[model samples]
Target: MGSASLWARTRGPSQKAHTAEITSGGIWTVAPQLEQERAVTGGGYSTPVGVTRAEPEVNVPHPQVDAVARRAQERVADAIEQLKDYLAIPAISCEAEHADDVRCLATKVRDDLSAMGLQHARVLELDDALPIVAADWLGAGRDKPTVLIYGHLDLQPVAGEEWSTPPHEATVVGQRLYARGSADDMGGWVSHMVSLGAWLAETGTLPCNVRLVIEGEEEIGSPNLERFMDAYPEAFEADAMVLTDCENPSDAVPGLTVSLRGLLEVELHVRALSSDVHSGLWGGMVPDVSTSLILLLARLLDDDGRLAVGRVEVDEARRAAGADVPLTPEIIREGAHLLEGVEPLPLRGTSAAEWMWWQPAISVVATTLPTPAIKKNALRQEASATLSVRLAPDQTAEEMMAVLRSVLLTDPPGGVQVELRADGWAGEGWLYTPKGPAFEAADRAYVRAWGRPLVQVGVGGSIPFVALFGRRFGDLPLILNGVMDPLTTAHGPNESMHLGIFGKAVLANVYLLDELGALGRDGIRS
Candidate 1:
């Protein structure tokens, strides 16, 4: 699909257009084009603070990263060469045709991780389910905390006809890389591998006792993760988990995601008659089930777009913890481009910051119905709808689902057979009270790496695993960080990351290890 008209105009300048001289490791001269644009627009640029100048002594500037970048640069040809081979083997977990391919991908990933210095890296085979790849590096003693990292290797189902480029081909044009899994996760996974390689190559040991777990069922709602977690509780027990799944709020504001909205998804199916009656024959006499279902679904939210369900409410106490910071109206307005010409949703008559951080919203994500053209002159027998209830930290998934089902079932429009099938995944929201050593170390590292202090924000999306990890290791100081920009189109087509932002991410991760050590040595251990 073509980009939005506004996005086409605001695609922004290329790196060369933004900077004149690109330095290797540290400081580099700003491009004249970018300087002029900044001067005219009065928008400041953020560069990694002290690293503008090169530091040549200690590390090799991570040759692995260079090699990876070179490989990425040749993505077009590589994608072409690998296209048929990849697409021919469907890896859809839901389908039997692709099961073997899924297993193969798991093995390939484990082998890659193993080559990246984790000699013992291997995949954990879950019976009757996709496998999860795990690796461990115990560089530190038990006195030091272990950092568990999580990611996934699965891709959503891709029908053959829906593309201009090959589905499995890691195609690159100019600077944009295109592929089925390139952006959703595969690219991100590759980045972690490269980063790990860089750290191992330079330090010969990880900064902490680390465990890496990458599952293949994330896109499938992680059907087996919790079961696996239950079977082996100690496998992922760690001080922190670095989830690379999320995105940074904006390129300028490198943020630490403070919270993720809980998810409550359900499909409400309404069935009227078993057989189709011609709409022409039954025009005025019969009640259209699709119409009734639509009307009922419309009442789910108030005029303000907030969920009218009783369970979806803000937690004042938790809200006060992060409270709304300085997110501006202009930022929210610009971000609502997802709605195109439609006006932005009224978020409880509050500032974008407050609404995003403290409010719950209900979205009718999808409703399935036969084509109007295919409609017989029949009273529609059934129509099914899906709703995504994004809950605030105060709400529970069970409570939200209960409220939703009750509201729909309470008053049905007469003869329609409304069967609300509350089926979908529910992951709880999290609000961590940042304190003690890990937070302090992370804060210091972020501040030192970038000139600005870390901005904590709540994301509209959920990881589903963070809450699980939190429950597994109560009171563990979990830190979250990432480099994907807010408008990076992560799950959507044309997903890309800012190179400069990624470089800063690497520097941040590198310093984070040292900061953690400092925190431990200075008596912050609990």
Candidate 2:
């Protein structure tokens, strides 16, 4: 077959080629065959290094290791099938027409959890909120540390034009798994299930007590999770919480997210006139709303792309998130896909790295305007633009919203009536210091599984529940480990999973349990 056809043909990782080598520098590199070709030819490729034992050949054939790896792969395939079934049920919380889809997905999750041999698995039913799937296995001991695993099962609505294939169908192309929720939470959630199954199949028991809480309304800003946290604090109290819904660094680096930026989405509306008037007669007399909107947005940031809000500092953010790293420029250009001939935007007089990880960003998500194709040669009287602001650490959504509103409306651009209001928000930042036995166990497991140094990083985007969970369970460390690459295009169309990393993720979780088991129950005792 031609290269194009081969690239188009979807195959599982077991069928793909691989190369394993221990470099003189002591990094054990495992390059999957599918990625090797791409890496040599400038395709996005990743080789997870130092996570496994040094080996000269790819696909180690030790019976016990091979058995465990094969079991993990099989579980991934089974979960892919399960994911396809789950995605087919469109549980769009934003749409009122698909309420049944939400329930159906909940029922499926409950059933899947039950099938995993957990002692108790049931949906946490609510009157108006989508039910949360709650499951737990205590095993034979009362002293075992109970680790709570959290993820969302619902997905955002999909549009046909936005996807290369049907977004709901789990399309396997080469070593990639493509679907709407395939990468976001569905894929991440299913990974937890499959990894648990591998542990069960290989050892006949989990490394420690496990409680799984998968929700259905996370995509809709998780308006009900805080209330749920309050009502069932007992169920949530645990040694640690494992969040698989966070972002990973670029494909090259393995990272544990230590912080996240908050979000504020606001709409600024401007009225230049009471009604549309003929441009020929009113062109010079009336101000244009579109022009005013652009000018207003421009004032939010200085020429250096830093927020101009009083007392809002972007340099501190850059320093906090480790903006002095080498991957800044490459990762930014790769992540943003800037227009051709457009240079990377500088952040506080530094490279894109400083701008991306450490700095705040203001993006115009959408603008309401009359279509020009049907233009009636009339001057627009009113217009609105939605702005998405990424707040730095230590900043509140309300504070940022107020600042944006004040800036947009405080000084009127002559001839325009302007108003600003908060449209949506995912509240502000958090920093995680992983302490106690659980964190030590996680560190050991990651090292044993991947043979690499665990790098601590900060996610620029928001995970709304991270901060909420911090307040609910004081002093308990939250472990933010995930497999979504920066270019994974999560929350967009044609999302995919890199099978190599997915397999490694399974091993990491398995080893995490093993390390925790060594800590005994009292180590995690609060």
Q: Which digits, one per residue and each the tens of the lDDT, describe model 1 over residues 98-184?
A: 777888988877886787687568878768888888888876676666777777777667653445466666554543445555545
TM-score winner: 2
- What C-alpha lDDT values do all the predictions have? 0.58, 0.66
Poorly placed runs, candidate 1 (over 4 Å): 1-96, 160-167, 171-177, 187-189, 230-237, 271-282, 303-340, 353-358, 365-368, 414-417, 521-525
Each model's TM-score, in the order given? 0.74, 0.81
- Please state the error at residue 393 of candidate 2 in Å: 2.6
Displacement of residue 80 (Cα, Å) in model 2 is 3.4
* lDDT tens per residue, model 2, 463-484: 7777888777757657888878
RMSD per prediction, one decimal?
Answer: 8.3, 7.7
If candidate 1 were superposed on the true structure by all CA atoms, what would the RMSD be?
Answer: 8.3
